[model samples]
Target: MKILLLGQHGQVSRELQLLLSQGHELIVLGREQLDLAETDNLRDAVRRLQPQLIINAAAHTAVDAAESEPEAAFAINATAPGVLAEEAAALDVPLIHYSTDYVFDGSKPTAYHEDDLPNPLGIYGRSKLAGEQAISAVGGKHLILRTSWVYSLHGRNFLLTMQRLLQEREQLSVVADQIGAPTWAGSIAAATVQLIERWQSAQTATWGVYHFTARGETAWFGFAEAIAAQLQAQGKTVAQLTPIATTQYPTPARRPLNSRLDCSRLERDWGVRLPDWHDGLLECLNASR
Candidate 1:
């Protein structure tokens, strides 16, 4: 399969490059080759590549920074995805795009499902929700995967920040109120492969929206503690983890208190399920060494 992956250095993109390269003609494009903000250029590249499958791993992911850059966020997160969807539809190929759990307002007591109403709290979430709507409005064969708290050894994410902070600071305070699965980029990539394999093998693969994230849940403080635990086990002098409320460390962009998304629909429909967050963190940490 000639797969055109839209991101190169992103955490999930890096994992996809490694996983998808085994048996496919993978053509990866960084911002230099094809910038998402450049709508015309993005459309032209997709048309020219004419890949069998289109996987857009690129996104404007700076949550807090997005508040100040709404235009850039919408251009890349909302507009670019719609353009990709239109092109993919023209070619009659499946479009695989990643989304986020931030579409919800976190008022729900339990996990959010595909049918749940979206009430984004900030510019970043609103932009992502707009992107989802755009793709749906385009009416193409597309997979809108809504995951949360994506982290890996690469790129800027919670995992890397915590790892470095834990070693440098003797004391640290982490937000304990915000809860969600700290999904590993590798876990997301592995699940994406399952979705692709099912589609190619003529399996029952329905496209629309699905929550693809790691199992279980943990607050940011718990996630940090987990990272600290692993570092300490490695004979590193880790930071003394301290739990702090969200109000104590406010960000430019508001985040949902609960970002858990129910991924049962994905398992039932595509026969793919991710591992526990703890297990995934361990796997990712082990892989780094």
Candidate 2:
């Protein structure tokens, strides 16, 4: 299968490039090749590529920044996805897009399922939810995956932030109110590849939203502590980690109190189970070294 991936340099896109390169013909484009904000250009690029599969890993992901730049966020996260979906539908190709767990309001005590209603609290989540709606509105064959707490070694993410903090400070305060899976980009990429393979072979009409993330859940403070522990195990001195509530460390945007996602739908459909967060974190840390 020929696949065209947007956001080629992103953490998830880099891993997707690796995973899809082996068995499929993959063409990647960075922002230089195409600007997602330019709707016509994005549509033309997809049409030109004529790929069997279109994976949109591009998004405006700065949660706090989105608060001040709602329009910019909507342009990229909401409008661009709809454009891609419309183009893909016109070309009759399968569209695979990534969303966020922020689409939920975090009112539920348990992990969110695919069927759960979305009640985004901030501009970031609202924009992503709009993207999901756009994809659905296009009436195309699509898979919108919502994942949480994404981190990788290659880009600006939680892992890198934690590493920097570990080096620069002897003590740090992190929020313990938010809980979600710390998913590795590589794992998400691998699962995407598997899903593509299954879809191609089965030729089944599989479409709609699903959740994909590393197994298990942890608070941001706990996640930071784990990272510190892992660094210490690697013979690095760590600091005194302090857990604080969301109110203590206010950001531009209000994050969900709970970000856990239920993976049952993904598992039931694709038979892919992500590794635990700890294992994924270890792999990323090792790779970062």
Candidate 3:
């Protein structure tokens, strides 16, 4: 299969590249080659490449930074997706795209489901939600897979930050109020290939939105503690972890207090299951070591 991936260096993209390259013709375009911000160039690139499958692994992922740059965020996260959907629909090919759990307000006591109404709390969430709407409106064969708290050995993510802080800071204060599963990028990549293989074989999954993530969940403070425990196991001096409330920390954007997403629908339809947050973290760290 000829696969055109829209991101070259993101955590999930990096994993996807490795997984998709085996036994497939994979074409990847980074920002320098095909910027999503440049809508015209993006359309032209997709049409010219004429790939069998289009996977948009690129996104404006700067959550706090996006608060001051709504236009730029929307350009990549909103406008670019709609254009991809249109082009994919024209070619009669399936488009695989990623979304986020931030689309919810995080007020729900339980996990958020695909059928739940979206009420984004900030520009980042709002833009991502808009992108999902655009793709659905275009009426294309697309998989809008929404995930949460993604991390990997590559890229800027929470796990890397915690690893660094556990070594540097004598005491670390992590937000205990906000909670979600720490999903690994490699796991997401593996699940994506399952979707592609099934679709290619005409197994036919219900097309639309789905929430997929690590099975279990935890607060940021708990995640930090997990990192600390691992460091201690390595005979390394770790930080004195302190749990803090959301009010104790402020950011440019408001984060969802509860980012838990239900994956029963995804598993029921696609038969894909993710590891627990702790297991995923261990796998990621083990791979790094």
Candidate 4:
């Protein structure tokens, strides 16, 4: 399959490049080759490439910074996805796009389901929700995957930040109120590849929204402590982790307290479930060595 993937430098995109290259013809593009913010250029590139499948791994992911750059966030997150969906619709090909857990307001007591209503709390969430809506409105064969707390060895992520901070600071305070599963980018890429294979073989693919995340949940503080432990296991000096409330360390953009997603729909339909958060973290840390 000729797959045109957006966002070459992103964490997930980098993983996809490695996983999809095994048996597929993959054409990965960065901002220089295909800018998402520029609709004309993005459309032209998609038309010229005429890929069998379109995968959009690019997104404006600076959560706090997005508060001050609403236009930029929406342009890349919302407008660009819609444009890609439109082009895919025209070509009658399947479009695979990624979304976030921020689409919810964190009011739900339990895990969020695919049918749950979205009530985004910040500019970043709102933009992502808008993108999801736009793709659904475009009425094409698409897969909208909503994941949470994504981290990996490559690129800017929570695990990498924790490693650097543990080396620099003797002690650190992490938010304990905000909770979500830490998903590995490699796992996401691998699962996406599996889904593509299933979609190709099946007579009719299940095309809709689905949540993908590691099993179990943890607050930011717990995640930090886990990272610190991983570093310590590697014979490195680690920081003393301290739990702090969200109010103690406020950001420019508000975050959802409950980012837990119910991924049963994905597992039931596709027979694919990501590994546990701690397991994924350990694998990632091991891979980095």
Predicted structure with the largest lDDT when compared to the true one? 1
Candidate 1 positional error at 88, Å = 0.4
lDDT of 2: 0.90
Pairs with backbone N, CA or C atoms under 3 Å apart (clashes), candidate 2:
none
Query: Is 1 or 3 the stronger prediction by lDDT?
Result: 1
**Deviating ranges (above 4 Å) for candidate 4:** none
lDDT of 3 by residue, 1-289 (tens): 8999998999999999989888999999998888798888988998899999999999999999999999999999999999999999999999999999999999999999999999999999999999999999998799999999999998899889999988998998999999899899998998999999888887875889999899998999998899889989999998899999999999989999999999998888988788888998899889876
Task: Evaluate all candidate structures by whole-model CA lDDT and list the values in order.
Answer: 0.94, 0.90, 0.93, 0.93
TM-score of 4: 0.98
User: Residue 149 CA error for candidate 2 (Å)?
Assistant: 0.5
Residue 228 alpha-carbon offset, candidate 4, angstroms: 0.9
| Residue 264 local lDDT, model 1 | 98
Q: Candidate 1, 120: how far from true, in Å?
A: 0.6
lDDT tens per residue, model 4, 150-219: 9988889888899899989988999999999999998899889889988898834888899999999999
Q: Worst lDDT window (10 residues) for model 2? A: 197-206
lDDT of 1 by residue, 218-240 (tens): 99999998999888898999888
Q: List all candidate RMSDs to the true structure.
A: 0.8, 1.3, 0.8, 1.0
